[model samples]
Target: ILEQCYNLMDFEAVAKNTMKKTAWAYYSSGADDEITMRENHSAFHKIWFRPRILVDVEKIDFSTTMLGTKCDIPFYVTATALGKLGNPEGEVVLTRAAKKHNVVQMIPTLASCSFDEIMDAAEGDQVQWMQLYVNKDRAITKKIVQHAESRGCKGLFITVDAPQLGRREKDMRSKFTDVGSSVQNGDSTDNSQGAARAISSFIDPALSWKDIPWFQSITKMPIILKGVQRVEDVIRAIEAGVQGVVLSNHGGRQLDFARSGVEVLAEVMPVLRERNWEDRIEIYIDGGVRRATDIIKALCLGAKGVGIGRPFLYSMSAYGQPGVDRAMQLLKDEMEMNMRLIGCSSVDQLNPTLVDTRGLSMHTTGVPSDTLGLSIYDPLVN
Candidate 1:
């Protein structure tokens, strides 16, 4: 174990150095020109904290509840697919780490490990949520949902974005570079999606608000729409009668120029407050959650909790289970220090007043997409 992985970004460098290039491209690649992916991280720079003093800051509690579940922290291990590519132990490693931290883990539908394998890895009544890419086959989707509920899953995060997987050219380039072996599935196996989207091609493009009730009928788990982008869609989500909605752009994997999750959170919360609908549903945002302050900003903007995906995968990829354990601990430490410095004693004390989102919506740096530069670029250094 390297003792110097001081923060989340440190893990990225480790993972990049540790993992194979093909796996790195798949794990790191965003949609189209990856404009939104970069923006997701950069947007957090816009929000500034309003710290207070002359108050009791001796103790700080960062624990919070989401979708009627208690979590040790306000961040969940958001779903990411094909964990085996990162480490041979696959998603089960993440499951054990989440259980240890008492943090919720949202299991991806396209996980390298089977649903049973991932759930079986859990100890006791460890809460895990399901991330569904609604299949075209309604029966198959229903069976998957109901089975998840039967196996003690608490929440259903239906991915409302990514009807079709975006063309990640870097990932595609890996396929082109590979001299595939015939013993596996033959030369005509159609390796266009490489391994990441191997099992993800069945996502139904026609999923809409009308299908919410159909999902409700099949399972009793709290239904959370995972890719809601705008305030209007959030209002529609409330009208659709779901239990929660995640403000995500599919981790900047589905759309090219879509707004970052925190940026959208700033837009959504004020409306929820105006309509007095903040209590109607739980709201979560994933993407660009690289640090504790980013998580704090999202919490201040009325997000129930933020989801962190890539960093854990990077840590797990580079150092396995121990890496993930340390990654979670680092965030917990940062949260305590930052919350105390900002004069916050608990997660509930975090509000819109704690942070200024005035610059959150502004895109000051217009980064023109340079294909070759992006190909060799190291975003972790930034």
Candidate 2:
């Protein structure tokens, strides 16, 4: 099964069979009914491509810079917690794979491996970023941020969406218990709690817009809000003096019916263009991005890059670092082929004219049959 895996979705199928039920539920489940989870992938189908012919796309350049670092592709690994649950080597496996492929890997706040351990795993000039889950103790948050900066982390991606962990019923049903007290907060050390609740107890629910300035005062690393869903917040993010934003819903794990990041991108791009602030702040998105076409669509609508979380985790779970390396290679091949087919020679050439977004915001009845995402959330089947 591992050798048969070619794409991220194949890895996902293999991972379901390889991983423990509790770990699989924790990684795959979204909030409540998971309507938004399914929507994230299906939303891509709503967008139709307007490919141009007779254009010379013989020499295509898929390389793009993200947060001042150049990546070989337009997609990078997003932060997903508890990597050791997927593989014993944990986030270190991802670090090795990212370095091998010249892509960035965002280290999660709740990673099974320590911050320095993940950093130490990197070889050569590999660029890494830290995903911050703000602690209730501001002093602790400051210390973590400064430490990451000292260790050569490129950016600080602060997760802003989860004021409280959403109701992920699949995890609740599994009754998955967290292994140890991951964070040093004096909170409940009870291991009986589910994965989300146990690890997230240290996160400060009181986090607000006013705290952004304090974060700016702490470290010089670029601050990107990781869970922005509203257009008005993007305006606030620009005014708040942050470097960038990742339009995401915590991979649909935070808010059940929250709009997909791609859908939010569709809404926010026009507003940013109208305000003449589209290029002022770097924009990235993550949620239900499975295919190369999904990444291309995001770039066309003005994303500096796209983040993929679960797929990479699944790949690592099924086949370790080699699985991740293979997944990246497959995406690169797909993007290069699609670039020629779409009549674009480079990432910058992807524009609004290349996509049709008329059906993006419209409500649909059932899950579209074309996507594998819908079945992922169906507990009875998996």
Predicted structure with the largest TM-score when compared to the true one? 2
lDDT score, candidate 2, position 179: 49
Residue 281, model 2, lDDT: 96
Which pairs, if any, clash in model 1? none
| lDDT of prediction 2 | 0.86
lDDT of each: 0.83, 0.86
CA lDDT for candidate 1? 0.83
Candidate 2 lDDT tens digits, 1-382: 5668767799999999889998998899999999889888888889989998999998999999999999999888899988888998899999999998899999999888888899999987899999999999899999999999999999999999999989888887887765463332224344464677767788889999999999999999999999998677887798889999999989888888898898888777776776688878999999999899999999998999999999999999999988998888889999999999999999989999999876874543233323323233232343
Residue-level error in angstroms, candidate 2, position 257: 0.5
At residue 382, candidate 2 shows an lDDT of 36
lDDT of 1 by residue, 195-228 (tens): 4455555678898878988988888899999988
Best lDDT among the predictions, by candidate number: 2
Q: Using Cα atoms with residue i matched to residue i, what is each candidate's TM-score against the true structure? A: 0.91, 0.92
Candidate 1, run of 10 with poorest lDDT? 179-188
